[model samples]
Target: MDSMLKADTADVPARENAAERLAALAYDDMRRVDALILERLDSHVALIPELARYLIEAGGKRVRPMITVAAANMLGHTDMAPIRLAAAVEFIHTATLLHDDVVDESGMRRGKVAANLVWGNASSVLVGDFLFARSFSLMVEAGSMKALGVLSAAASTIAEGEVRQLSAVKDIGVSVDTYMQIIDAKTAALFAAAAQVSGIVAGRPSDEEAALETYGRELGLAFQLVDDALDYGGAAAQLGKSTGDDFREGKVTLPVALSLKQAGPDEAAFWRRVIAETDQKDGDFERALDYMHEHGALNATVEQARDHAARARAALSGFPDNAWRRALGDLADFVVERAY
Candidate 1:
C-alpha cells in the first residue's frame, strides 16, 4: 500500500485525449487496419455484415488494434503483416465486446445502444462468432503461427475469465486476488497478446517481446481498475454506459470488494442484500458509493491502478526513446488519470 501510494503521487504529466493522441500517432497504420477490418467484415450473408458493421461503425477507441500497429511500428517493421494482425486484434476485441454485452445484459456500449439491444441476443452472439472466425482468418493470413497461438490463447482465457467472474458475481466474499485474476484473464490477456504478437511478427527478440507483453498487461490492469472505479463515480455519458451498472448487475468489483472487507455488521448485511441477494433498493447504489468512499475503497483501487500504470510506463524504458514509446507511456498515465 505504501508503494502504491508513492507511485500514485509520482509525476506523470497528463495529456489531453491520450488515447486520441496514440491514435493519431498510429493514424496511417490504423487507417489501413480499419479498411482491412471493413473488408474482412464483408460477407455474402447480408445480415452477417449488417450486424457486425453496426457495432464496428459505432465509435470506440480501437485501443487494442492501436497497440498492435504501434508496437510493430516502434520495432521498425514496415510490412503489411502487422496491419493484418492489427485488424485481427480489433476483430477479436470487437467480438469480445459483442459477447460481453450479451453476457452483462448491458444496454449501452460506446454511447450507442448495445448491439444485443438493437439486434437480438442471438444475432449479437452469432455475429460475435462470425467476427471471431474472421479474426482467425486474418491471423492465419498474417503467417505467424506463434502470433496466432498467442491470440487464440487470449481468446480462450477471456472466456475462462468471464466464466470465473460470473461464478463470483454476487459473492461478496471474493478477495482482491481473486478479483485481479478475473480482470487479468478477462481484460489483460488480449492486451498482452495484441502487443506480443506485434513483436512476433516483427521477428524481435524474446526479451523485447516480453517487455511489450508486460507493458500491455499492466496497462490493461490499470485500465480495468480505473473502469471499475469509474462505474461508481463517473458520469454515464462519459463512461458510455450507465453508472452503477455493476451494482445493478450484482458484479462485485474492486471497490465493492474492498468496502465489504471493512463492513461493520449493518454494512455487511447491506452488501449481502444488494450484492449476494440481488435485492437492491432505490437508494442502494448511492449508499454503496457512500460506503466505498468512507472505506477509501475507490482511492485504494485507484492507487493500485496507478501502481500498475507506473509499471506499464517502466516496461517501455527498455525500448528506444521514440515517439511511439513516449506516447505509450503517456497512454498509461492517461489510463489512471481518466478515473479522476
Candidate 2:
C-alpha cells in the first residue's frame, strides 16, 4: 500500500471534467471513431438499429473505446484499424450495458430509461446480441487475429464475471478473492482487451501489449471500485442511475464486503437479513451506509482504487510523455477521483 500515493479526497487534484479534457486531447481521433460508430450502428431491421442507436448515442464518456485509440496513438499508428477497433469496442460495451441493465434490474442507463424498460427485456437482450455480432464483424474488419481473439475472449470472460457476480450477491461469505475475480472479469477484461488489441493493430511488441493491458485492467478495477463507493451516496445521478441501487439489489461490492468482515453479530445478522435474504425495508439502506462509513469501507475502497490507478499510471511509463500518454495517465487519475 505504501507504494501507492494517497491524498485526502479534497487534495485529489483532478480538474472538474477530466473526461472532457481527455476527449479534447484525443479530439481528432475520437471524432473519426464516432463517425465510424454512427455508420456501423445501422441495421436493416428497424428495431435493431433504433434500439442500439438509442444507447449508443446516449451520452456516456466512451472511455473504453478512447483507451483503444489512445493506445494506438501512443504507438504512432496512423491507420484506420484503430478506428474500426474502437467502434467495435464501443459496440461490445453497449451490448454489455444493455444486457447488464436487464441483469441488474437497473431502471436507468446513462441517465436515460434503460433499454430493457423502453424496449422490453426480450428486445433489449436480442438487440444486445445483434450488437455483439456487429462488434465481431467490426473486429473482423480490423484484420488481426490477435485483436479478434483477445476481444472475443473478453466477451466470454465478461459473461463469466457477470454470472459470478450473480452468485456473489447477498452471499456475505464471499471472500475478497472472489470479489476481485468478479470485477477483473466483469469489468476489467474488456478494458484490457481493448488496449491490448491496440498493440496488435499497431504491430507492437508483446511487452508493450502486456503493459497496455495492465493499464486498462487496473484502470477498470479502479473505475468499478469508485462506482461501488458512489452507490452509497448521492452521486448516483453522476453514475447515471438511482442512488442505493447496489444496496437495494443486494449486490456484494467491495465496500459491502469489507464492512461484512468487520461486522459484529448484530451487524452480521442485519446483513444476512437484508443481503442474504433480500428482505430489505425502510432505513435498511441508511443502516448499510452507516455500516460502510463506520468501518471506513467507502474510504478503504477508494484507497484500493487509488492503488490500481497508480498501477495504471505506472503501466504507461514505457511510453514517452506525449499528449496521448499524458491524457491516458490523466484518465486514470480521473477514474479514482470520481469517488470524491
Candidate 3:
C-alpha cells in the first residue's frame, strides 16, 4: 500500500542524494546567503529579530534561495547580486511561513513550535511584514530594477494565492484545476521568481530566463503536489508537521479534491460531514486516508507530480550541460521522491 503512493521514477537513475550533491556544489554561496539572512534579520525592535530568528533558524531546506544561487552560478555570475537575491528569497519564504502558521493555527513548523504559538499572531504577522520589507531592501541593493520587479510581483502573487486558498477551505467542490492555480500562486510564484531573478541579474538571454522560470514553476508545482499526497501517507517526522494537518484544517488540497471527485454517495456523505461540515471525529483522518487510497487519489496525485517534475527537468534542457543543470534536474526528481 505504501509502495502505491511512492513516485514512479524507475527509468531515471536514482539520485537519492541529489539534494546533498546540490548543497555541496553550492555550499560556499549558500553560506554567504545564510550570513546575509542573519545579518538582515537584525533590528532594534528586539522582538522583530527574536521572532524572525525563531522561524529562520527552524531548519528549512532553503530550497527557494538555493534555486536563486544555483541559477546564478549556472549562468557563471561572479557578483554578489546572487547572494543578495538568494537572501531576499529566503526572507520572502520565511515571511510567508510566519503568516501561514498563524492562518492555519499551526502548532508545529519544521519540527518545532510554530512562531505564532510563542509570539502571538499579531507579533508573527508584524514581523512577517518586516521581513517582506527587508526583502525589498535587499532586492534594491542587488541593483536590478528588472529583478526587483519580478520578485515584487511574486510577493504580491503569493498573497493573492493564500487568500484564494483561504476562501476555498472546506470546499469539497474545488476542482483539481482550481487547486493547481492556488498552489501556483501560493507556492510556485516565489520559486519562479527566485530562479528567474537570477537570470535577470546575470543579464542572461530572455529565452534562458524564461526557461528558468518554467523550471522553477514546474518544480514548485511538483513539490507542493508531493506535499499534498504526503499529508495523507507520509511520516510526521518527514513532513515536519502532523501527517493529517491538511485534513484537520479542512484544506481542499489536491488529494482531497481528487478523492471527492471519485467518491460515491456514501463516501460523498462522509466527506461532506468530515470536511465540508468540519465535524471530524476519531478515526476520521484514517477513514479519509482509506477513501483516498481506495480511489487511488494519492497515487494519481503523485503521478501528476512526477509529470510536472519531468517537465521541470525538460525546462532545463536549454541550459549548459553542467553540474548545476544536472543538480537542478535531479532536484526535480527528488521533489517527487519525498512522497515515499
Clashes per prediction? 0, 0, 0
Against the true structure, candidate 2 reaches a TM-score of 0.92
What TM-scores do the predictions have? 0.93, 0.92, 0.93
Model 2 misses residue 301 by how many Å? Answer: 0.2
Q: Residue 330 deviation, candidate 3, in Å?
A: 0.5
| Candidate 1 structure quality by residue, lDDT tens digits, 1-340 | 2222223232533233566567778989989999999999999989988888888898677888888888888888869988999899899899999999999888888778898998899999999999999999999999999999999999999999999999998999899999999999999999899999999999989999999999999999999999898888731213333478898989999999999889999999999999999998898887888888789998999899999999989998988888888888888987787777
Indicate which candidate wins on TM-score.
Answer: 3
Error in Å for residue 147 of model 3: 0.7
Model 1 is weakest, by summed lDDT over 10 consecutive residues, at 1-10
Top candidate by lDDT: 3
Quality of model 1 by C-alpha lDDT:
0.87
Give the worst 10-residue stretch by lDDT in candidate 3: 1-10
lDDT of 3 by residue, 200-241 (tens): 999998999999999999999999998888888742224343
Candidate 2 lDDT, 101-196, residue by residue in tens: 889888888878999999999999999998899899998998998899999999999999999999888898887788999999999999999889
Which 10-residue span in candidate 2 carries the lowest summed lDDT?
Answer: 1-10
C-alpha RMSD values across all candidates: 4.9, 4.4, 4.1
Ranking by TM-score: 3, 1, 2
- Residue 21, candidate 1: how far off, in angstroms? 2.0
